[model samples]
Target: MIVTADGSAREPNFNRHITTPNMRKKSINMMYQWFVVSLVYYGLAMNSANLGTDPYISFAASAIVGIPATLFSAVILKYLGRRLSLSGTMLLAGITCLVTALPWPANLNWVIVTLATIGMFASSGTYGICFLYSGELYLTVVRNIGLGSNSTWARASAILAPYVALLGMYRREYPLLIFGVLAISASIAGLFLPETQDQELPETLEDGENFGKKQRFWTLLPQKPSIDNNSAVEQ
Candidate 1:
């Protein structure tokens, strides 16, 4: 047993979470992940006009696209698992945006517009998944604190998103390239986090300390738990 700052007794193992090197690393990484995700997601959203579409139409279309993307992300989260779905969508979003950033002929404006909308769709999906992922990743005791802290970072991202998009004023592709790089970076960072889809939410600091230690790659495929007993029950 251990006593906390508030003089409360805790489970004997609970103290380990406070001192665990892995836990600290994961927490710091997640902070960066949330910031990057928010920055790119909103940056693309606010700068939709750069896609060469009517700004009003693009905004409405982006909102409409998000409806289905959210529903589809639920299915993606269920089957593809959190890690792959996030990384895949983010990678797709980044690639599509980078495609627009290329020095293509003006004749390809329609292609660029199409890619921007697709990137928006992917970014929306990634943003939604992050909400679910962050909620589940934190322990009950500190879940609100963790989420609040992340939200603050997200707001910071939101504030910077507009300025980042302003780069497009100087060079049209500047914002697109920036969004692409950040989205891809977020995807890579996501790879380091554990898959949380359908898995039991961490209820205590100890559970969080041990979270993501189990390897259940590609929840899309079927696997026998005979080899690893924890596999079947983790999700």
Candidate 2:
């Protein structure tokens, strides 16, 4: 394992995910991912609020939504991809949340609730996609830990969420806006990672590289070199 600048030992393997020969099918798998995940994830989240007309209804609706919603997540993750599922969930959740937050007709409260529910449904799908997809994508050695890390981080958000809500939520619509922005951000982060819907476990570093692909990261560079031969490539 190579030591990164921060002195941490990076994974010895290069391919961050498993590989599948059928690239087309694997990539196509992504399309189903987002919508499916959103169906489950955001569904549960919104149920606590969007499920009904008032907070109590929302709470009751949220509880009701969780039952079938979780089951659906299981069903979809069995068929869809990890990356696509997650990204789709993020996008749909973000979009729908944004839509719900918009200033529309007073009569449209029901419409907003409907829209919010749809986003919640998609959120569950995303949760499934992320867990199953990433687990299968990575090699055996790191698979559990990698997926675990991801799962932990995700759970952390949920755990801390109530605190966040308690801290801020001045406006009635503020939480929706926050959720919308967060969903968008998560989708963007999903794009930065690799796609591993249906594939074989990567055996070598090169395999991981081929699968994961380079992504945007911070870089530090020194100034340009001088124009001399001693400074060879200098400007």
Candidate 3:
């Protein structure tokens, strides 16, 4: 066992981490977010062939969108902060998925493909943000445990993603509808999490518990320095 400088044993207390109300809520929220994001991300890719476009083109479009989506995620995380950026992308993805599942005329197959492409774009961005956001949410003591648990949820969803795509054989809309509902639900769950932008990482369990307790729901953006205050200081 590792001992701290104070000569106390540094064994991680998994029970305390899981049983604490705040940490527990954060874990549940992140689990759902990870599951839904992974499900939608992989589901969209696998369901590409059913988008009524050339399978090759549809697949390529999904793959290529990841570049811009990741860049977009970086911009949003920097400006909008973690909570809003994550939920916003997931919400956008959910809406597009729901629209894509609508029954449109065959002539409007292009519309379906377009919406699906947009969903893919948003899901990819959420996927990138989740990796960073999860780390910030957990205390350093159990950070590895938290991330590993979230990754397990993601992998479980990925395993089921192919089967979700297979639902397309019966009705192409079924898979998309499922993805849409879950993404939206996850977005709502994500909103309960506190914004982590410009905040110090939680280094202890107590720190994690109290991190975002003071934040209101509407506080989604990072706090910027007041230009007037800066000018006054300079003067």
Candidate 4:
């Protein structure tokens, strides 16, 4: 039984979760974000060897950088809120990926490696945040279904990432270029999603539909009490 907005209980209907306007919009946005995050994360890892560095070193660096990035993501998610944290990391990844694709002097291979590593770091952070953010965005009644669908999209993108990397055969920058564009686009899409930090998770269809309705596009942090307002109230 699901408790609705009006305090009535009813059997959960799976179809309503998908058909509702707000729920549908949020799901689409999350699916796109998941797809891009998976593609870039896997794509960069797969193409690390082609970034003008030793394959073993590049691969190992990619694996190791994720640790600090995940920690940084946790810190930012606690303060910056889900929408900003995800979008900021994705935007950073996108910009770095694009910069890494730029033609540079052959002697500057280390520069390429550095930029690629940063992109990987940001992508890694975004990947970790998506798991928590998606859970919060979904209604409790269909949370599992929502997460499964997003995961399916992510896996599908992962499968296609190798093909994206293969484009590097024609031009080494092609893979990063694609990944960058997608990440930037996903970042923009993420802004439209409601910030879920410190907010109650929706349990019913009505709750899902109404969730975050009051927030504007620029609202990135949780609301806090104003000192002036509190002082005035005390007076």
Candidate 5:
């Protein structure tokens, strides 16, 4: 029990514990999302050399794509908002992987490599946007905890990424199929995240509790115009 603002004693709300359902749901969603993102991102890198090109050349190509992807993410984050940018990139990455799943000539290994490279590029963009978006999702007081936990998922996914690529030993397209499905799932999960663009950050636990309470959809719509209080006073 504690004194209230009016000096009345009250029992604390035990329902809002760290293990509350809301908190658990948010944590689990973020964990899965980050896991899939890292899996696809690193899977592409690990499988690049197996696309029939010289190992050095394929690795170089994959590494180089990150440069442009990082540059493009700045523009996307500014104009497109965080949710759309992340979801769209993840979807694009998934699509590229799916394309390679289709049966193609053995000599078309270069095409497969190109598509995989594009997927990696999009995944890199997702990486940049996801970190920014996730940081904004949690309250400032627990920001590090939230991000650190999500990053732990990313590391776990990275550890599994090589095994995902190793599925190529069974079938060349197996890795692509798995990564493609995971990327698509990540994009779908992204759609559920609230848009944080132009919104004030939550500075306290109470402030964060109500964050994302408004479940608005199709965030790309033009924002509603706000009335100017100063203009009303002048009038």
Candidate 6:
């Protein structure tokens, strides 16, 4: 509909015209991104002592795992779609977890440790990008609210991560089991979500909503205003 006084149609796109249902559709998958990203911190808390000997070595060990994985994820995000990148990271991280669980000797511990380090780094980068991905998903009007809520939930997980890790450590096998389950679940969620890689920004809520709802120009454009030739002739 046109604004009667001004006569300008709404800006062309889904972001502005998007519906509540559009927003709700992707909520579950995005939440997984938020929650699972924070799990690495918990993993660190539980697994640090498993590294043995000097505490600095353990700390260094964690950092080592995180750095490369972080870099790999950050660089690949733009190149690959969000779903593929995240799914790959989680799947590999799961493998890394299983590898780390292997009964290797102290001398060969470096190999398993390296895998975990890579997983941490990859997980860190994947988690960090959620802020960017979610921010890009919504329009500017509610952009802050949308992404902020997601980030809040993700970061909020930090408060409970350590406690869970400590509690799980009390039972020895619990933390590993928990991470294993989360890793698998997140990978599945990543696989199911729609790909939004390199798509143009939706200027309004409706534009974002209709992002997948494509149509021809004639379908959206209104009829042009007609000239009153009689009035012109009388003048």
**Per-residue lDDT of model 5, residues 95-167, tens digit only:** 9999977887878878877887899899999898879888888777787999999999999999999998988
- Clash pairs, candidate 4, are none
Those runs of model 2 whose alpha carbons end farther than 4 Å from true positions after fitting are: 1-52, 67-80, 167-169, 204-206, 214-235
Candidate 4 error regions (>4 Å): 1-19, 224-235
Local distance difference test scores for all models: 0.78, 0.55, 0.90, 0.91, 0.82, 0.63
Which runs in model 6 stand beyond 4 Å of their true positions?
1-19, 51-54, 65-67, 102-108, 212-235
Model 5 root-mean-square deviation? 3.2
1 or 5: which has the higher lDDT? 5
* Predicted model with the maximum lDDT: 4
What are the per-residue Cα lDDT tens digits for candidate 4 across 54-74?
888888888899999999999
lDDT of 4: 0.91
- The Cα RMSD in angstroms, rounded to one decimal, for candidate 3 relative to the true structure is 4.8
Question: lDDT tens string, model 2, 164-226?
Answer: 444224544566666677778767656555644434457554464466443222211111223
lDDT of 1 by residue, 1-235 (tens): 7799999997876434365566677777677777877887788878877666577776776677788888878888887777788888889888988988888787776677678788888888888888887787788888788888888888899899999988887887999998888888877777887766556667867787887677544343322334456766786
lDDT of 2: 0.55
| Candidate 4 displacement at residue 33 in angstroms | 0.5
Q: How close to the true structure is residue 116 of candidate 2, measured as C-alpha lDDT?
A: 64
Runs of candidate 3 with Cα error greater than 4 angstroms are: 1-19, 224-235
Best by TM-score: 4
Better of 2 and 6 by TM-score: 6
Report model 4's TM-score to 2 decimal places: 0.87
Q: Give the TM-score of candidate 5.
A: 0.86
TM-score per model over all chains: 0.81, 0.61, 0.87, 0.87, 0.86, 0.72
